[model samples]
Target: MDTACGKEYECMLRITEEILLLILDTEQGNIRVSLPAHTRDIVIAGAVLMDLAMEDRIDTDLQQLILVNPIPLGDDFLDPTLADIANATDTHDTAYWIARTAERGEQIRQRAINRLAARGILETEGHGPVFFSRLVSRIRRYPSVDGTDMEDVHVRIMRVLFSQDIPDPRDALIVSLAASCGVFDSLLSGEERAQVRDRIDQVARLDLIGRTVAAALRQHTPSARSRKSARPHQQIPCVAGWPIAGHAFAMSRDLRIFLTRQYQRHGPIFRIKAFNRRFIVLAGPEANVFVTKAEHVHLRSNELWRDFDAATGSGRTVMSMDGPEHMRMRKVQAAGYSSKVIQNRLDDVIDITRRAIDTWPMDQAMSGFPALQRIVAEQIGLLLTSLSPQPYINDLTVFLETLLKIQVVHQWPKLMMHWPRFRQARRRVMELYAALLVAHQPENRRHRHSDFIDDLLELHRTDPQFLPETDLPVAFLGSYFAGLDTSASVCAFMLHVLLKHPELLARMTAEVDALFDRGTPTAQGLSELDVTHRIALETLRMYPIIPGLTRTVSNSFEFGGYLVPAGAQVIIGNTVAHHLPACFPHPERFDIDRYQRGRAEHRKPGAFAPFGVGRHRCLGSGFAEVQIAVTMATIVRETELVLERPHRPIDIKQMPLPHPAASFKIRQVRRRRASGTV
Candidate 1:
């Protein structure tokens, strides 16, 4: 080969790289499983042989593989196989060399991945999932679920398969290699595969190396039953069930503890059937990594939340949508839901928090969770929706939690929606929504600064099809609900931890006092509450607000050698890793230092997913953190609260969501200073 031509070949993606990329399910970070196991290995081996032939190191005809130039290419993926072929004492056909090379498949696969990562074609963020990209820069591109911008191989292959253009020898060889391995099964849908099958066959016949690869793979292909039997003889363990209740009773008793026990016993992946709804439970750090890397391709959220969508009376909410549509909707509200939104209005938030604290009767015990929730609801309204939640807080709470209990958790009967109190609450909340809609219309908002509602209103006006008028009420209410509930839960938990650890409380108090001494807490000042920040993170690690997420498998994938097939319901125990001693040393202990620079345990891959993971990962996570820290700081600087008299240990109550039991109360010992005096 001419020197220039050889350099050109060097610049081009190698046949091995092309084959690996072709078979990779980029969205899932796994080789496509549409074909049986080890097919890619054979195809990749054929690629190595073909590359050798092209380089004049070997030649192949219908009957025999002939060594031409015995010199090695020095390519890691090809050199070993080439040397074997060169040193062979006896001659053999191409099929013999292909099978022998296939034995090195795992090593070949790893080398290709390492090369890809080195080339910047693939990237890894920290210890997170391998990310695929076609873009040249280092920016992270999370490809859309349906498909991403087609990489060069995909684009090239599709162009050749669908058109009348004559194929290049290299293209023809790739087509044959892919055809032999059934890669088209995944790269194309059924209709597309049928359309291109004849063309593929014609192209496969055009290259002698391709034809030999095809014949060999066809002869070696395992039968369907044998292939099924060949899969690893392992099954995900199932939790013990009780008659018709399945594992429902145990899950209801305390899901976090139950799941933690299951993780301890069965490791990360297991099965639990509850109320005729069987779920494949994925727990611990490893499962988090798997889901984070593959969720966009292998899981869908709409199915799991369909009942909640129906209960909303609106067609769909952002929480229930997936793929590009979900992304589009999330973009619509992204700015409004950001921490910057909360940060920009820190004073208003602090004011609302202070006012709520002032309402507590002096020296009297109050329900901690509900009291904190009410305060958060008020702050969420003023800052997010420009409404006062005081009049409608009870109504919003009752209406939202009732629907969540019935529709999301399946804790109550559908008939619970019609109970008189629920009906009253629902009616009041609808009225509240209606009022918000009217108040936020373009004309009515002349003087008011834009909030989340304004963003929705503008979108509804501009793109009715995208954000229809009918969806506004539910969207508005849902956004409000998101801010109110989780933030309060985190705040309550942070408070509990602070009270339990008086030394930590003292440290936090000292930190807050220092912060307040810097004048009114600016976003910059609030952000610098390092000790307080660690406390908040540690609290979240110990008592994650949303313990786990429910999803439905949209595509079949193997986890720990067990096939979690398509259409299975899954419970992602995302926060379970937080409690694992492997992920966090002495996890039950409230040690804020775990987040310190020396430890930094949460920085480990999938070790800390308090906001869950992947596409549906909590977008408001940053906002929640700031809101919690700010609230905790404000409370510490303003009032002295102690565990209520006849102190009872914290007990979690799970229904709509996990929160400290009603008996968990706090009494205000005294006002440390007048509200806002700090």
Candidate 2:
């Protein structure tokens, strides 16, 4: 091979450089001695395949890698690998080559390190006890004659991964390689990894080669092979009573109570035949960890919520999407609810809350649920659509309430949805949403301020594929549907909890008053109200609005000593987990202090599930938090509230949102004194 060809191979260090940096622990300045052998082999083998593709020596079409050139690349590390592929008599696929190459991964790894050492980019030393005889190396970044440190390569790669900069092909390949091997955690500290996780994930998706390699690994892994061969050992424990309708009626009546009773009888993992379908229910923190962390292929959200698709609409909202489509939509929607955007809208949120409070009758008793629902609906309207709920507030509230009911009892016969009253209500709600969409269009929009609608419009303008025109109305209604009822339920429950404990309410009131005395409620000021924030968190833990989350299992797996078969539906009950004596000690108590910095009781894994978890966690969590906190704080500071019927056990509705019964009433009187008075 000629020197120019050798130079070309030498300059193409895309794969090798990624492997070296990943294998090195930057803090310790040495090779990560704890790197597992199997993972290391898989990553190195993947790197070799990527390098070959980048060199134009090979290419893949769907299932197989076709050799494009048989000529030697003139680099010792790659030339032999190329030769092996060229000499193969049988037509081979990508996975076959990856496995074949991985058999010699240790040799490939050593040679790459030796090349780096020769270039003074790394220093090696004898490691382990004398008899063991192994080499340990540390990266060296000393400035070369060209005045560039070798370490700059690592920095440049990370910068490309973290920044919005469009990465060159090489850096994109590196990110794909790292993500495929699951080595991101090894390279970055937990905090640092979180900060750049989204960007890294975006970049990783760009590398088709890496994705193919990862898919191959998943298919051929020992676990996959064993799962394919093994049959489920025993039948999953099933809840008793109701064969045809199964446990559907009981589950819909009160999921928390039903699940808790089943848990007591069947332990952590059990099956409930519900709505003529079997659901595998997993409860507690261990179950939380297992379900949330399961592979996307093993469990999916869209399939679980399929029954509601007709009522909710299909392929038009975030909740209906799975995998890459869901992820892409989430990225676009995140812009509207980011901390910066929420902060910008904080004043509007506070003003809306204050207005709702002022309109409440001063002395007459009123059901807290409607008052809170009205306030929450108005606030969601202003923040999400930049529209006030004037002339249509009642209509909008009714629409949302009906939609929530339909979602909760969505399993009813298809004919029920087509009933005259139900269909009319559905049509009315869609018309209201359609009107909102039309009013917010670029040509028709009256308001100048930005909101979620504006953000989504911008996305649609820039990338038509990001959100289709048909989905515009559904997306808008979905955001409102998600926030309005859930927020109202939480706010009502908070009022109930506060009225039950006047002292606790007093402490929270003081905290809010102190913060507002400093200045108006800026995002920074609102965040400082630790007591109020804790109250919001504790309320959700005790009465999670959506008590249970369900998913469909795509791959069979073992959990809590039971084998959950593929194609089964799984339900994880947040209410059940929250009340576990093991998780929250005094399970029945409402202690806001549990979420205080020092206590942080909810920090225990799946103990708190108000916003759900993992990929399916509520997108509006930040929006929900800010909306809840500001509303609670404003009420505490501006009005003196007392339950009209005190000590009435809070009757929580079991289906839809865990709303307090309408009988829960409160009497409010405007504070006589000004800002700081409590």
Candidate 3:
């Protein structure tokens, strides 16, 4: 075909776009799971080459590729490959160009998807939330914006495959590309494929470009065994354990201990099986840096939290979204959940802490975790929405903990979500949020201080499509729960550590008393509490509440000489650095001075990640830290904490979130500062 003549046969979707549409599982919105991810890249590269051929920019015979015209296509995806072929001085075969282009498979795929999204034919959206469905939310979905049942390329391809009608040259190329990548294996079953076998081969021969693609891919595509042996990337080492159970029992017994041991034994990356599911663990300081760098590109978190999103009745949460949607929601809630919010309202936070402390019976052996949880919940209420959560603390705790266990942890049965206790707790928590919504109304809070809820309401008013009223509960509740679980547990651990070591406790006490000795605790003054700050840092490092992040590999990446492939479910062991002696000397010891100026072990990249790492690194890390520091300072300054059983070892409850066990009780033996005093 001549170059000018080929331009007359332009189709609705580009060859690359048509190939994408055909290979994509319409229901899931990602490339079909049955197709290897790399193969998708190779197919896309081939599509670019096919488009170039259609434009008469290039031509291929049985083996060698001939560059007829060196001109650009003006299309982003096609132009780059056209330029690459034009720039080459030496002659190369079709397989050479395909391999060269496919080397940038991730970039090519993303660019094609981005262009498709920009054209408005397809919209990028998350799996909103299904009640009990197994979610693969990690991969993105692109449903047609028109809401029509018929997908043009898919319908057209099937029409050609199942019938005797001849396919157009474009459709023939798509058929060839799909077959070359084994996409037919996923789209058509063995029986269906068997029926279409002769037709597919017949259609694939219609275009010379299609025949070239078929031949190049057949000759160059390595078998699974050859690819494994040829490439330096080895299989991730799996932790030795039983067939089905794997390390579930060991992990359930003590997660931190098991993870630390694995890091030491297996080095950075390894795999583990829990029940029927397998997870690859990326550990140590290097893994932390790798995750921080790769999070937005290669890893994602929304798929892991879809059940939690559904259980919240919000359909989606900021934590359960990726790409643009996640960023938009995160930006709306950023200022409201920041540490500056706590810094501005230091007096209110201190007052809330003091009042909660006063409620603790003076000489009674009260449970540490629950007591601290209630106090943190109260502070979150006052600071976040300017509404007290005091009455609904128990209800909120029950509701959040139950959903976490059932949805996030997968420890409890999903049916537990329907239990009456959870039902009532959820109702009460909703009532609390309902009250918050009412309290933040413009007329109701005319003179009241604007808060996180007010910001959410403002965003909803401006962009309801993005921040719908239905999602308000999760928007508010997400921030509250983050504090309730992570910040509260850190405070409990601080209490445990302080109670365990009298000298450290006394040093923290003196630091707190000195901070209060100055008029009011300014953010500057709170930040300067070196001993107290180190204790908080040391506590977080020693007792990380959320140890590792569970994510799906969005793009295949190489780490420590092993290739972590796309579509893998992985646990990035972010806290592995905290326990590694290389990152911190004598990591097991309770040494607050590791964070001191001279040592500053936590200053290293990936060495200290109590707030997690990467783009999803907790937005409220500053808030959590200040909350812990101030709460610890207030408690130490006001009353003395004595462990109920001083000699008993601190028992850890590791499921859902790790925290000091209820048996780790503390009683206030001395009151240095009265509840109502300055």
RMSD after CA superposition, every candidate: 8.3, 15.2, 12.2
Q: Which lDDT tens digits does candidate 3 get at residues 114-232?
A: 76666554434211110111121222223333432224677788999999987776778889888877889988989999999999988887777788877897776644324332223
The C-alpha local distance difference test score for the whole of candidate 3 amounts to 0.79
Off by over 4 Å in 1: 1-234
Candidate 1 structure, TM-score to reference: 0.71
By how many angstroms RMSD does model 2 differ from the true structure?
15.2
**Which tens-of-lDDT digit does each residue in 1-678 have in candidate 2?**
101123444444447545765576433333453455566777777778777777778876448878988887666777777898899888777778877887787677667766655555543321100110012223424334344444445666678866798986666767777776667777678998889888887887766765666666554452333333333525667678775888888887788878877886888888787666777788767776655545344577776545455555544577767665765577567656655665777777677777777678878899998888778877777767776655455555555555545554454445565666666656766676766777777776655766778877787788877676766766776666776668888889888888898888989988888987776778888888888888888888887887778787777877776677777778886567788777787978888878877878877766777777555667777777888888888888788988887867877766566688878889976663444333
In candidate 2, list every pair of residues with a backbone clash. Answer: none
Supply the global lDDT for candidate 1: 0.79
Better of 2 and 3 by lDDT: 3
lDDT score of residue 463 within candidate 3: 89
What TM value does model 3 have?
Answer: 0.67
Our tally of clashes for model 1 stands at 0
Error of 3 at 360 (Å): 1.8
